[model samples]
Target: MRRIWFALFGGLFGAVGVAFLGAFRADALADPTSLATFSLWLGASTLYVLGGLDASIGDFDWYQLVGLGNVCLGLQMVARAAMTLADGTGETEPLLATFGGVVGGLTLAYIGLDWFRGGRHFDLSTFEESPTADPE
Candidate 1:
């Protein structure tokens, strides 16, 4: 069941990433802002797809993929906040968003690193356990 979910999500993210990259290519010279937005989306989608693949195949540490995803999301949010602020709307929302993104991204990355280093902050045995645990 989890593998199915991962496969579905991976396909979705792959499709979205391809679309975003196509759009970026089409309007490559349009504007710097669009470039930033599209690039961020592309990065996030790619990371998500990779994470999904890892989840499905058990080829890598789940926390690492999750951390990467969180970092990408944070970057996207920061970019959004920057674009909003650049519009000269004088809104505090952008500031808050940026702060939130930075804090969230950093925190997640830290947690991921700890987990990767065997910190064992929480038992993730459910995810680690697999029917293929024994080679027979």
Candidate 2:
């Protein structure tokens, strides 16, 4: 069920990205850095859904991991936005969007770390047995 939602969200993001790219001119899209960053985010989002499902067992408590992925994607988007601003080719809209992206990513990353520290309350037993546990 969660996987479905992740996949759906990723698809939606991809659609928006596609539209954004389509509306832009070819010369802008030709940027290798921009293209690579976008590609990485797309790939990461896709993997998040697929791999998350595979790793989860209805109790995987993956909010932190998912959050991390979200942050990563946001950072990429923000970087692209910053580039757009630097190039001075687009309106201020991209700059604002980039700022928003960076903020969103930072927020997500903070939440993820917080959860990892204590919010999620993951059980230590879930980890494989340590050699010391045997005490042979």
Off by over 4 Å in 2: 14-29, 55-65, 89-97, 112-136
In model 2, pairs of residues that clash are none
Estimate the TM-score for candidate 2. Answer: 0.54
* lDDT (tens digit, per residue) of candidate 2 on 1-136: 4345655676676777677777885754587777766775766576456434545535545554455555567567667666766787556776677778778766755654554454554432333234455656
TM-scores, one per candidate: 0.56, 0.54
What tens digits encode model 1's per-residue C-alpha lDDT throughout 12-130?
Answer: 76687677667777675377876776566666556556655565435556545644554555565656656666777656786777667667756755654554554477444545436
- Candidate 2 residue 128 Cα shift, in angstroms, is 21
Q: How far off is residue 41 in model 1, in Å?
A: 2.2
User: Highest lDDT, which number?
Assistant: 2
How far residue 48's Cα lies from its native spot in candidate 2, in Å, is 3.0
Evaluated against the true structure, the overall lDDT of model 1 is 0.59
lDDT per model vs. reference? 0.59, 0.59
